[model samples]
Target: MNSWLEVLKPEEIEEIHAASLEVLEDVGVEFQLEEARAAFQAHGARVAGSRVYIPRLLIEQALTAAPERFLLEARNPARSVWIGGGETVFAPPAGCVYVQATGTARRSAVPADYIDLVRLVHQSTHYGTNGGGIVIPEGDFGSDEEKFAWLLLAGHWYSDKPQMGLNLGAKVSRLALDFSRMAFGGRPGCRILGTINPDSPLMFSPEMLASLLIYAREGQGLIVAPCSMAIATSPATLAGTLVVNNAEILAGLTLAQLVRPGTPVVYGNTSTIADMKTMAIALGAPELSLLVLGTAQMARRYRLPSRAGGSLTDAKEPDMQAGLESMLSLLSTVAGGVSIVMHAGGILDSFLTLSYEKLIIDEDTGGMAKRFQRGIEVNRETLALEAIADRGAGGNFLDHEHTLKHFRNEIWRPQLSDREVYQEGRDYQAYTLAKATQAWQKRLEGYSRPVLPEEVEREMLDFYHQRFGSEPVLDV
Candidate 1:
């Protein structure tokens, strides 16, 4: 985590600081709704139409009030996640449209696709958390709400990885809480994921506010996202965009803390830009990468857990552009010490489409990033100053005891990515995309759904049935 600070020179930090202050003072931010304007005004902000002037002092005070670190308790305490300060967490892309399967290259993500994705995530040792509501196979479910419901059900059924629940209305939030209560067998605060969108002013919608309150009251962690778009929905400049994003996030954090102080929440930013030329959202832009890393730092300033965009690219096809963009943004966030990096796979066009090949590649990228975060060991054996002197020059250490001891520990072995020569490893027949397909298939073949007690599952399903007036399909 200290690496993040070390990477930023004093001048750079000062620049970011100055930019933040300018954003707070000169650029300001827009509060779309009157209620949010009223809230900010009540909270000592100056409001002029939709533009609000937030004093640096107020921003600093809010930062002071924000919790620096918190623990996300899982149903199994052993699996609980510490999301702030020193620890780091990862999440796959959410709300994507396609999934890659084994044997097949890529396929449209449907309800069944969700089930497979959940199962795969559950079984993977690599991924630390589960994200449902990813648009794999477009669900047969009636509406976005219904599709979200299916995601919640699949998450409950497939994984115990402290999953993110669906982001429907307040009723779904309540149901999700109830589902957690049942799934964990009355364990409160089992670390379910909830979202609060700051698309308007400083305030949350009644439904969203209620959801946050429910999650907070239950001791659940929240992932609040200010889906700000640069040069469009938000400020055109990066600094201005960051400030608006920060204010929006700060607003969510303040509300959550006020509702239930000390409730764990991640400072998540999915802010991106609409391309000036194409009028399309561009995730591959260098500015987006900088935004992600910068947001991580700003979140750290508040001593809060952080989440940011990752495995994101503007490429239509999963090619070099996709790999490069994903690697750059993801590594930046990881190095910036973001606790939860979402969009780790299957995102395109600012997250409207999901690519199976991209997902496979991203898994490799995520593995590499996690390895990078582990950093280099500085133990006596690893320092090897003495060993180097002993060997002098031109001595190969491959067969040495020190080499054997440190090499494995120092190196990261990738699954989907290839490093072999053309003649070796089946003539490098297995491309990462293909390997990912195989691995995903193998995982599904061996997949075992979480063993929820029959009665508990029945109760949860019954509740959904009663609420929706139909038997909830557990197929996915």
Candidate 2:
């Protein structure tokens, strides 16, 4: 019941695994950073100049050592989540450059927009964890550290769930780790979760490798994801892309375990095709769904959890095209049995823009998938055999106790994305936009900021002062 669709048979899974092993052993992968190359060489991987040929046995060893499941401890203990074991977690869309809403002009996001987005995440029932790097807030920062400090602080200030941010550099990521130590205060296990992306065509960037090493040492959560464009960065065929993508992910996993034997890493991906005519990345393609399905199968083979797929669309607005494409992509991701889907909401124009209106649409779309994911509970009470027996054949059960008791949990309702509500005076297109706008306004107006202790808030402020010139004037 985990998925309605299956892409790879058991034998096909073996074939893909063998191909990836061959690629890792014979073809080798380039390490753009000397430090990462040194780690592999130190761990007995054969290094040829800047390229490193990792042994298949080492890959198997790492896979055996990596945990099948783990806890990501949040700042609020009650908000902590367990990843893997077929359980899925949803994070709102993040890392978009531009922000747009219905009837409002599109523009670069500032600090206010970033804070608003974080607050919106805090208010949503659909998001399992707080989203991070939601916007690259506009600021005149003295350094990258300064910029990162403000952004991560905003994330902490706004939400209590597990959060994420840029993980390609060492200095800023380590700083974030230090902040987390203060935010969560020595809670056991993983408190920090991050996404470290590999350069497609089999390479890990210097910055990302540095970040990965720090995360591994800190016992933080990681999604060892590679974002490879099918025709551009990988072989055009889907099978070929999977082979490359798997090798890249395995190399990262191996490195994570090498730094720390039991490092928690998800077998992650962002592999999608390039549009033939436009040369733009095609996230809404049918092949993208297949890619996710295949990736999830490989992850299961290694007994690791998986990540990828999203409410993605190339449409510039939250219109009919966006709705259709987003629903299809979100459903495919859930059916693929993937975990920790990134960009699951608010993406538009292939990740160039984040539409507030679209975020509402995307959230509702993902909510539908979750409703489906709950499946059916066939217990004695849920079976309703007694209820039917109590009420005779001709008599209705609408007024019965069973119906009254379970009606709310039994029904799936969409607050803002009801397709049935679109047939009246307005088009589905216009209704969707208007409703999305209306939903966000209500959420913002209604959400109350979480209270922070005076001492902890002051310490966070001191950390802020060390990074930026002055202490932040926060509402919390």
RMSD (Å) of each candidate, 1 decimal: 3.7, 1.9
Judged by TM-score, which candidate is best?
A: 2
Query: Model 1: what TM-score?
Result: 0.85
For each candidate, the alpha-carbon lDDT, in order, equals 0.70, 0.84
For model 2, what is the error of residue 119's alpha carbon versus the real structure, in angstroms, after optimal superposition? 0.4
Q: Tally clashing residue pairs in candidate 1.
A: 8
- Candidate 1 per-residue C-alpha lDDT over 1-476 given as tens digits, one digit per residue, 9 for 90 to 100: 23772344556655666665666567566544555456557777788877777777766665665567766555556666767876667776787775544345455667776676777777766566775576645645666555566577768777777777665556778767777777788865545877777763243555666676677677677888887779987779777777667767766665455455567778888888888888787888878777887778776666778888688887766777877888888877777778877777767666867765566667778878878877776767678987788787998777777787777768878777767665544634346667766777787899876667898888878877776667667674
Candidate 2 versus the native: TM-score? 0.95
- Candidate 2 per-residue lDDT, tens place, 1-476, comes to 63546688889888888999999999999888888888889989999998999998899899999999888877877888888888778887777779998878779887788888989988887677775588776666676677677778878888888877568488888877877777776567788788888899889888888889899998888899888989999999999999999999999999999889999999999889999999899888888888988898888889898888888888887777877888888888887788778888899989888898877777779888877867888889999998999997897989999999998998887887555633556666676678889999999999887765677777888978976777664453
Error of 2 at 311 (Å): 1.0
Give the lDDT of residue 113 in candidate 1.
Answer: 67
| TM-score (all chains, Cα) for each model | 0.85, 0.95
